[model samples]
Target: MRTLHIITGLGIGGAEQQLRLMLRHLPTSSSVVTLTNPGPVARGIEADGVPVIHLGMAGNRDLGALPRLTRLVRQGRYDLVHTHLYRACLYGRIAARLAGVRPVIATEHSLGDAQIEGRPLTSGARALYLAGERLGTSTVAVSPSVARRLEEWGVRRSRIHVVPNGIEVARFAFDPAARRAAREQLGLAPDAFVVGGVGRLAVGKRFDRLVRAVAALPDARLLLVGEGDQREELLRTAGECGAADRVLLSGRCEDPPPAGAAPDTLTLPSLLAAMDVFVSTSPDEAFGLAVVEALAAGLPVLYVACPAVDDLPPGSAPGARRIGPSVPELTAALREVRRAGGARLPQPAAVRRYDIAAGARQLMSLYENAVHGTPLPHEVSCS
Candidate 1:
């Protein structure tokens, strides 16, 4: 059956990463449709030789764009439609239904509680999503917390499926030689303890909190990766915390760290390897992809105990330490992780729960159920 996967943008983010993994493992005939203009991820999909159609929808609620999207899905004769993120989920699912696809599936990637800066669609949007979800065949939640929120917002518990985000364990496998090479390439001293955090520079992510924590610790360097609307604000905050020099703001690195003592772009795997400890200070993360990436690299993770981190398997990695939701607690945890020698890097086997291949298999099954009208045997009861 031909499947059409839809997302808002091709920007490098968690939802985008998950969609890429799903497309990679799915059958060759599957196609990708982007509601907004494609970005970096579009190139990756194109490289895989998958057909991508861009609808060129400018604003979030572009009513006029819906008919064209619906027509494309209809003409393509897609059997299934899978959507990610807010705008794509709403418009894509509705268009899929109009196009008469057998199963319309959506993956909930955000907490649904936090509000976007310029886009303000709260109760009305929630109601719209609820109605669309009821009409669609199935819904996938990236974490249990997101599933709970959907239920609280009035989506039927029976229709929702909890499939946690996954990563390629082998891709993130620990590499000692790569770590050394990355340190040298980045000009990091051999004796310096490096703490790395990856994500958009947003207020909700609380990267400023990390800067504060890093500033309190002596002789520790921080690596802040990724780009966003909040970059300048975060930079100013880092300067205020007196960590401007010690913190390396490597913006938008597509490649992993170099192997064998070369300073190359920090790939997700290499960045995890080059770090003595990985820290996530985000106040609300639907699922911590960067945290799981660190775990897959056998690096210890210091995450704030939010609903997102609760899904992390208990005792799976020695470095998975939870800190209270305070700057002081986070600061202490970073110091302790450094002092404790970063808890002997974890084995890739420990992170099998988040493995992308496994996640792909589970998602495929969900799609099958959506198409065949059969209930998933191990379905998670949302209520």
Candidate 2:
């Protein structure tokens, strides 16, 4: 079957990553369209031989894009139209309906309230989202918590389907030799403690709080990955905390380095494997993709206790250490995790629920059901 996947921008966010992974694995003939200029993810998709379309959307409400998108969808005769992020879901779904595409679907990647822009749910934005949901044949939620938020926001439960985000298990599989090589390549002291945090350097990511916590542990070094507008602000915060030297701000390394190399020099998996501990500071993460990646690399994780992370299996290896909202509590937990020594990391089996291939199969089924007017299979618990 042919499907069209639309998103706002193909940046390196969780939603963007999920979309790329799904596109890579989905069986249908799929094409991705970005409402705005194509970013890094667009390039990645194009490399995989998938066509990437840019609609030249400038702002939130681009009325001009609707007609263009509608014409494109109609011309392509897409059987299913899947949208991700806020703007794409709103405009793309509507455009799909206008184009007479059957089975318009939108995946709610994050909770309604946790949208990047502080637009209130009671505002016009929410109204547009609700309109799209009503027009959509189905809605996909990356996590149960995300689905619950959609329900709370008044979307009918019958239209919502929970599909937890998936990862490429083999891509993130642990490599014992690579781990040691990464440490050696980085010239890290044999006993040195490293805590790695991966995410955009934005306010919501709470990187500042992580810096503060890291400052408290003079012996522990911190690795801040990813790039964003707040990089300068975070660097200043690190300087202010007098931990500038201890903090290694390894800005955005999208591609994992070669095997048996350091992250700054090697791939993401190697970088992750070299870490003694992985920490996610975001308080409102919808699904902890980076934390799971760290776990897959066999590093213990310490994340702020949020509904998204608490959903992981209880007895999973490299068992997660959940802390309160305060920076002090996080600092204490970091110290505790470091002192406790190495623990078994989460195995691929524990995280199979988020497998990209499995997630794509489920999404393909949803698209089929949406087109055939048949009810989707009973919602399976990823837990």
TM-score of each: 0.91, 0.92
lDDT per residue, candidate 2, 8-104, as tens digits? 8986677886787778788889888998868777887787778999889989756988999999999998889999888888888889889988689
What is the lDDT of every predicted structure here? 0.76, 0.77
Candidate 1 C-alpha lDDT tens digits along 142-208: 8888787778888888878888887767888788878887888787887788989998877778888
Model 2's alpha-carbon lDDT is 0.77
TM for candidate 1 is: 0.91
Clashing pairs in 1: 167-356, 181-261, 185-263, 255-267, 256-266, 256-267, 257-267
TM-score of 2: 0.92
